[model samples]
Target chain A: MSREVILGDIREIMADVFDMDVDDVVVTPDTTADDIEEWDSLSHIRLIVAVERRFKVKFTNAEIERLRRVGDLVALVEAKQPA
Target chain B: MLKSLSWLRPAPGDFRDQARALRSEMRGGRGDDLGMRLYALANHALDENQLVSLARLAAGACDAGAAPAPFSAVKLGVFGDGTLSLIAPAIAGTALRHRLAVDTFVGEFNRAALDALDPSGPVRSAGLDMALIVSDARVLGLDRPAASRAAADETVERAFGQVRRTVEGLRPSIGSAILVQTVAAPLEPLFGSYDRIEPGSPLSMTAAFNRRVADWAADGGVVLVDVAHLAECVGLEAWDDPGQWHAAKLGFAPSLLPVYADVVARAMAAVRGLSRKCLVLDLDNTLWGGVVGDDGLGGIVIGQGSATGEAHLAVQRMALALRARGVVLAVCSKNEEAAARAPFREHPDMLLREDHIAVFQANWTDKAANLRAIAETLNIGVDALVLLDDNPAERMQVRSELPLVGVPELPDDPALFPRMLAAAGYFEAVSVSKEDRARAEMYQANARRAAALSASADVGAYLASLEMACAIGPVSEMTRARVAQLVNKSNQFNLTTRRWSEGELAAAIRDPARHVAQVRLVDRFGDNGVIAVLIADKGPDAWAIDTWLMSCRVLGRRVEEACLAHLAGAARAAGARALIGRYIPSPRNAIVKDHYRNLGFALEDESGGATTWRLDLDRFVAPALEMTVADGFLAPENAAA
Candidate 1:
């Protein structure tokens, strides 16, 4: 799957978590925790769990901590996908 | 609890197809995994309304044609110190299995637990079945003075005193049960890790406090959840993020919420009395090493000498231990009845006997039919059964045939069987009542009654010939646990099946405005201990039956008639002008559709499927019971309701 496709799925998950439409989310490499209305500490954890379960991937604490934007999560998921 | 998750059956789908199929199901419906885990990824991420809707849709879709009312939600109150509000929604969402919905009351941040339990406390009227508390030195502001042993001791003692007082102050209304996490050891050093005296540390004091709480859990109303051990398991670095702690006062990191939710959900299930009641075992390779028919008694590997024999012996001993603690044991083997029972009777090393089994089916029939027959003979739903079989194919077949039967995966090695079964936690019991101790023998008596019924010409004559009698009275402490168990576990014969916890039952038994009784039946065969319970709300001139359920074993025996007669008399004696009963329709309780009408009660109202009936005390008379009554009997005319 392409990174855009993975990002689309992650956006859908984010939209569900925030109770918004998928199209309402506009993401870029710089879009981050402070940019989103619903992205808080607890929500960040839930988003990780949802994305990990969706992609059948596991993330390290360090990798999750390093993530600051949607692009970072998409890259981590793409890297962790089974080759 | 993995029911027909046929959607997840490794089909000819690629990874995307499988994921799409699962997502489609969740998008359009619920993904019922029988709560072994949360249904879908969306559940953890979505808010309460979305998650609960997905749960309900999935549950309705899973059980087709059986539109039972959505089960009542469990109410929980989370009262603690620190930033706990952020995690309440996650806990509530994670606990939503198909049959259970959890609603949480998150107390204000950093509120004291003792203050919450006060008379006008914020959580006083929540009426929670479970209350979760997270208290520690950091939450209580127990700062130390100049790093001395005396200061550490005083800090630990004060925190312990506060928590103990909070636990004592908690006046749990009726069904409320409290769960309190012990203090987590402070992993951080006061100043530096170097040259630290461990004995004078706060970590040592926290450990000391946890030990006392562990001892207190043995007799107190509070159940201790081992947060300190959980922190250790999660590892110190992941468990405590220094940045998050400093920023948000978070006790544990958000990443560990799933693990926390899993532990708490299981503890809640244990207290809610949702546990399996039967172990249906296949005799051939499951009980012994080889096929009973082909190998014969001596050839089977269940004797004292061989390693395989010892493995089989271990399984038998575990089954016997479970039976002793109220799990009914039965055998379903595909062989001649005599041939199957030969090892049980003849082998010197066999720990389980034919008497140990309440129902034994040894025929060439399919295993599913035999299991169904076993459940029917035992008068229980297939949901209450757990089957053990060594053969994977047989287990799969039974699973397909009866989705409700819990089939645990058995290891290839026979030696791992005992511990694997133990770790499954199938027979989790909150309290072992006196009636539970004699369950095995009582089932044996049931077998004799079955035999008597089969031999008699007519059912009524058989019932009359048995000289059966029942003793009904107020719920005493001796019978309170079993009464609550029956009220929770009984589904089919239950009219208005209401679940009451032991604390709730204890309170009801003492209230003069309420009427509660447990019925014990004794026949010529043996005594069936506390087979039924009935509760009613008593008013000035009217008494309404809140719940009435009888064991299915005595279903056709007119024991309910006798019970109603006794109720009418009691209502009249209490100056009640009328006795009323309600029949709320559920799929299982359809067997009791015309119960009140047949007993001469006039129909009062009917809405949707729920029906109410009333009996005027002036015209009602006690039904003439053939069996002698031991206690709680009124004279014939006194039973006027």
Candidate 2:
């Protein structure tokens, strides 16, 4: 999967989690939890659970902690994608 | 519980769509109107994300003051050593499904012991109706391996002691019912295959600790959450999450939070006396494989010979087991009464016989009305009935019409029917006593008496035809538990509606100034064990009835008349001039609102929906009834014989 496609999937998930329209949610490579109002610690875990489930991948604790932005999640999903 | 039943159908697309619509409504203005829908979605086997979404919507609806009226608001205290921020919403959401609006006070994380011990803690001072202590293996030290068998036993004892102390401390501080969870054993096992035999292993120690907890809870009258059993149902690996625990100290997997909340809610419901009493089953495709009306008895698939037949047999077996544990069984099928009775009467392989059914209503009428009629005939609230039907249309109709009635969605497979019902936890009971074992047979006999009554020309002749025998005596050690059960459970036929613990009953029995009557009745059909309990106080002038409640099964049988006559005779013998009776109205027990008036007591005082009645012993005429009466409850001659 391409980075744009992974980012698009993440956007859809964030929209659902945040209860927003897909068009209303805009995620860029530098978009971080600080950029989203609804993205708190609890919602952060919810997002991880949803993302891992959607991509059929598991994230390591250290890797999940290291994630700083939407781009990091997108890259992690891309790397974990089955080739 | 719903998620554990893998045999159940995946949440239908329409259900998800409906849930989405309701969720969107929460964001919009009309979220309050969606309380019942949100409750229904919580009961469905939805994934964790959907559950969380629905929970948010339900909380919003409740906050908007649009919670349904059938729910009883409960102030719940959830004290856990792990992260409980996520769990409170899950509990509040799942509790709505059980008809409870839970306002939870989440205790400080890693301070379960301290919070429970602190008399002035926020959780204890919140005036909680029930406290749920969520214990995990990490906090209980069940995740630690012991070096020897003695060490394992010590670990188990220490864990149980800590839990017992916590419960005891909370008891004095909160004065609310306490529920504790059994720590789930860690999935990672040492000694591999030998783990089962190794007493010192962490798994074995956890198992031992759980056993100790169960015994202690039984002795202390505490409710066990049984999370270990729940974890086993959905394999331990799935139940526990290393990633979540490592990151946030989440005790269990966040995905399993919904199931955990469901289990705790069921235990709370049982504590609050909201457990369902009856399992109303459909005949065709529910109790058996094939349609009994369409297919002949021989053609129907139910028995030992085939796999399909065995699957159907499993449903009947589960129903019988529930009946044995005091859950009344009834039949409400969309078939002719005779056609429905045929399998139970004629099928050699059928496990549920006619004697096991309390109220069998098999007809062309809509199942919703039949369920209402069944509840009426059984003298229970419609909410107490759970209809298990394979036909989705029938289930949907019942759900829409009677939202209080439990209608579990049945899987297409007949084999999964029993598991689906079990997973629903509709007939969850805190404890079963001796009277529960005979509950089904007594209801069946009551049904037979109802039939006999309709056949007879006169009410007097009908009651006479019952060949009824009455026994009245003081509450003894033999009848204390049963009396307490009736005192707490009987609502419709209860006057005063005073709930007394067994300890209180024993004290009343011992007090010389008080008279406790343990009334049991037997007809030619069967023994209706301890049908009525009356506690009266012996005053200077009259005998005042403190609590009077009879089983509704014996209603219209003139059992109350006989009890009054016995009380009058005893009062006169004790030189009392009159008898005083009080009727305190409750949400239930309205059936007996005019109980004293109908029984010839003159109204003396009326206030606040409660009335006091007085009967002159000098003028009291003992109405002659056509039944034998034994003074000591059980005749010594009969016992000797």
Candidate 3:
């Protein structure tokens, strides 16, 4: 999947899991902990779990924390996406 | 207690004339002399006449305004002699005004005015909001003469009875939300009574009265404020001057006001339906004494001996009480799972076992991170948490980082720990149903079931051999307590966590549109009393499963399938079309992650974890299982003739 597709999928999962609007999940590199009210350390893990299950890709805990923005999550997903 | 209204810059007469006109309007048919007499009484600093005038003015205002805003919030009516009078001013909100209408009338004449107000007239017509009858704290004063004791009790009961009658009569007008404060009897020998009684006494008669009031409100489907408990926690003496029953009527110390304000605020919150859902506890110093890591499980102080052990026992006891009151207890500790499991397994005196906790997070991580895992496991919101921990630093970290969670201050002294913990208001449930009492055991039983499933290759064969006996009964008087318990506490299995006390549950069972069934499952493990609840509203030739939740412990046993089959049979008998199942996702109930979908219900909608499923009753086949159907367990009311 492309970065946009991964970000879209991430946004859909975040919206569903956190009970937020899909539009609320802005795909930007600058997005961090301050970006989403629901995106805490725990939710970050859950988001990773959801993303891994959705995209069928896994990220390390260090990589998980480093993926601060929607773009970062998309990048991690793209990097790990099966060829 | 006298406040000269004349001291105001505008002069008292300016307001007096307006009050006189309102009084005249209220008593138009009566003679001017009578009106002037009432007016003079108001002018001569009579609170009774002034209250009459105020009531009339309020009635007139309501009569002139729009149906009094439909009192769309929880209302609390405060019927107290003086303590409530002090607390009322500190509370400001529509909920306060709607719920707590103070009767500032004084003396015998005040009672006469209240009595004289025609129940059929504008006083009732004004749609006076809910009432919380607060008993006079002075009645409980130890310094009161012996003769006054009986009189005080009589007075308190009489006042409560009068308010009860008024509320009973105003049921249709008020719409059934009356919270009465159980009067906390004044500590005897007011000046030195604080020292006379042992700390942490099983609440005074006043506290008991408040508890009864809470019971009454719960029974009446109204909100209850446990003032006695709240007051006792903050030190009753702190709110009042020594020897004086009522706090200084005017200009109360700011430090003292917050405690009273909190009581009122909590009361209003409950009345408005704002309550915490889960209590997330730290296991080490919080649940029991000594670290599980260093104590090696055997060294932990849980059962008896020193005050440390007793304190831990007390906390466990309190936690059990909380669970009984519908507060889901979850563990979020940084300890090895096996080490943590040891105490729950071996410690005989451990107040809380593994079963009492709905979810356990025993891992090595930041405490907040563990809490998050627990939240995810349970499928509940972080905001719905009351985090309890002994370490101030940990508590502060959670407090600052997770602003939504309620982090209570921990006491430095291990002895004062339980009392401090109880003051957090984590489990301020108005009523405890029978289902609540068995909750921890059921959850613990579920853990056993989980273990069994992990060991077994054939889950179906294991479920069949467990010899599960399901008894489906229509809710009746005997099962009312359990039914109400399920209604309030069954969040995960619950379609909607709509809480109803026993009385309300009984009433709902009688409603033609609504159908409620209690499911009791007993297997080789033990009797899990009425562990499942099904609530649905009847549609045109069909039933909508408003709520279908089974205790998580009963999950793998195919109990959900059995319950659905039973309900489908009932629907078919009732000549219904389809059985609609709803799966509303809560933060903690993810165990039922694919509940409706697994049950073969066609998905109608899936928005934000709120999923709806519909199954045609005709096509839906009950899974064949060799389970015993218990006879005579059917509710007597719902049993076929």
Candidate 4:
């Protein structure tokens, strides 16, 4: 998926998981965990679970730890996509 | 007009004198006489108009001598019609009252109630400790049989809906609990209905009202007290009879007053998280008359045609009812296992069989030891047990040894045994779910599964043979109750002890901005109902998991691993790059302390008791499990995402 499509999907997932409005999710490349109240530590696992299920892919502990910002996440998904 | 006055004549002079003494005792001498005088005036009022007049008079009288404001307390708002005004003085005098309103429409009443308690609202909103809504049944027009029952139900629903919405909206603002009182209507025949209604029958209507009202209360996270149920149990007609209207004429019965007070008090306790979960019974004296060793299985007083036998039968029936409501029942006795098994096998009148009990400890051991063993066997904390024994010595032993277990003082009178047990407040659920009735059977089946697993060498082979299938989707209205049950009760695998009611869960699903999923697990063992719940919110290039918890019984079978893999795949398909996992450690969740670590997530940071972990979608691999996803289980939208 393209970066724009990836951002939209992430926004939808964040809205569904955090019980927040979709508009509340700002899919900026610089956005971090501090930007959302619902994006806590436990929710991190849930996000991983949702992402893996959506893309039919999985991540190692090291890769997951390195993903800190929206830009990083987009890069990881792009690299993982079937080419 | 005559309706209000007819309530005063039953109290004789002696009763009036006693009531005055009680009021004075409660008031601690200062303004006691003034309170009594005002109370008498209100009681003597002849009609609704007169009652309102006397209530206003009482309010003015109390306001004249109101105590100086305390430094730290939230001002509560009490709302009701005329009847509420009559009782306002009693609640206001003792409770911290910031403001009080006599009557308003349901919507406006709740708004004002919230405002009066809000810190930002007018009256310099102090924290509201509680809001008491005490309307009269006349307001709903239930006194007239010609009135539409449907309309009455709708009015009650609407009124409670407003109260619930207000409570929910204000919960985050005030951070205080809310309590509600049901309108008490006169017990009059509805024309074609039975002329003389039994105390138990009214519970049907009261239960209906309670269920309806609880829908809103649960949504708002408010606590509700069904005074009508308590009143019926203690005989409502006996006190509400036309003869005993006035406090000066017929005083409130001390016996009935305690029962009513106890209901409210217990409800308050439940609000503070002080409810018991287990019911422990002594086999010999409690379940039957004679010891099984002495009387033998055939001779023990458990079958029909005897008084003690009948009493034992009644206790069994009550136990079954308690078990049906999710109260775990266990035997903590000093009898041979064979002897205990014989009664359940041979007795015809036994209402509770071996299958009904989640744990059975009939070995020759200390009662306390037996209780601990039973708790461990059932996977529950010992503190949740409520021990009941006929022998005072045994009860005392358990009380002193295991202070955590609630030892209800059993009555000496055999006839009052059932009543006393009923009053001991066990199995009190805010609302019962379909899963509750099937809980004991499920536990029994789990026990069998445990045994089977113990006997088998290959755990994976055992799991594979069971043929487990998972049905995953967004929770609908029908499954909301089950979803809430899993969220509230499942502790071990739960990342966060986040408890949500049915209404709240429903609201979350209806909101478009969230992705909520519930996993239903069923295997050869049995249906685990909604065993797992996963709530997530979409963020920039990732879906954040809000809550991920599964029933502990379904653990060790790689179910959580399967669920995690499913969530990660779903998130990636939605174009999210990385998956995030979190661990919020609780006192009871140490078993899952390394869950994220085992799932191959790397810790990002740690704060307090919570730790954050993340996984990149590119490198993540789903754990292999011997399970199948039921066809057409995923929602089309979720599939697309």
Which number leads on lDDT? 2
Once fitted onto the true fold, the runs of candidate 3 whose alpha carbons sit more than 4 angstroms away are A1-83, B1-131, B134-157, B173-177, B186-224, B229-236, B241-254, B264-363, B373-387, B400-406, B451-467, B488-501, B507-516, B534-561, B574-641
Q: Top model by DockQ, which number?
A: 2
Any runs in candidate 2 off by more than 4 Å, and if so which? A1-39, B1-38, B47-67, B108-121, B173-176, B292-295, B335-347, B358-362, B495-498, B501-516, B535-547, B561-586, B594-641
Question: How do the residues B1-641 of candidate 3 rate in per-residue lDDT, one tens digit apiece?
Answer: 10211111122444445555554665554333432233222222222222333344333333232212212223233444444443343342212222222222221212422532557644345444455444444443322332344554554455456546654544454433455555444554443554334222222334434555666665545566555554455555643344222223222222343344445545554443345667888888877878988977778887678778887888888778777766778888888999987888888888777767878878888878777766655545575677878887887687556655666666566666656555444445555556556655555555456566668788777787677887777776777765665565555655655556566677788998887877887887777777787888888787998777766546556777778887787777778999887776654466676777788888988898788888888787777865866422234553521
lDDT of candidate 1 over B1-641, digit per residue (tens): 11111111222323223333554565664544523223323222233324423433434333333322333356777766656755566565545432345666776533445555566766676666677776755764443332666776666677777776665555453244677777656666665553145545666667666777777665435677777776775576667755556645667765566456545655665565456778998888778899878887778899688999899898999999999888899998889999999988988889998889999999989989999988888777776788888878887788778765767677778887876576445676555677777877777677777777889998778988889878777666656667877887677788887777667788887898899877888888788878788899998888999999988878887889878877888888788999999999864689888999999999999999999999998998776776876545343232211
Report the C-alpha displacement of residue B534, candidate 4, in angstroms: 0.4
Worst 10 residues of 4 chain B by lDDT: B96-105
Question: Model 1 residue B641 lDDT?
Answer: 15
For each candidate, give its TM-score against the true structure: 0.75, 0.85, 0.56, 0.63
DockQ of each: 0.21, 0.43, 0.01, 0.01
Model 2 reproduced share of reference interface contacts:
0.29
Q: What share of the true interface contacts does candidate 1 keep?
A: 0.12
Q: Could you tell me which residue pairs clash in candidate 2?
A: none
Q: Note the residue pairs that clash in candidate 1.
A: B30-B58
Model 4 segments more than 4 A misplaced:
A1-83, B1-119, B122-179, B186-224, B235-262, B265-277, B457-467, B585-591, B631-641
Best by TM-score: 2
Q: Write the per-residue lDDT of candidate 4 for residues B540-613, one digit (tens) a residue.
A: 68777778898776878788777777787778777888878778876467787788888888898899979888
Positional deviation of B525 in candidate 2, in angstroms? Answer: 2.5
For model 1 chain B, the run of ten residues with the poorest summed lDDT? B1-10
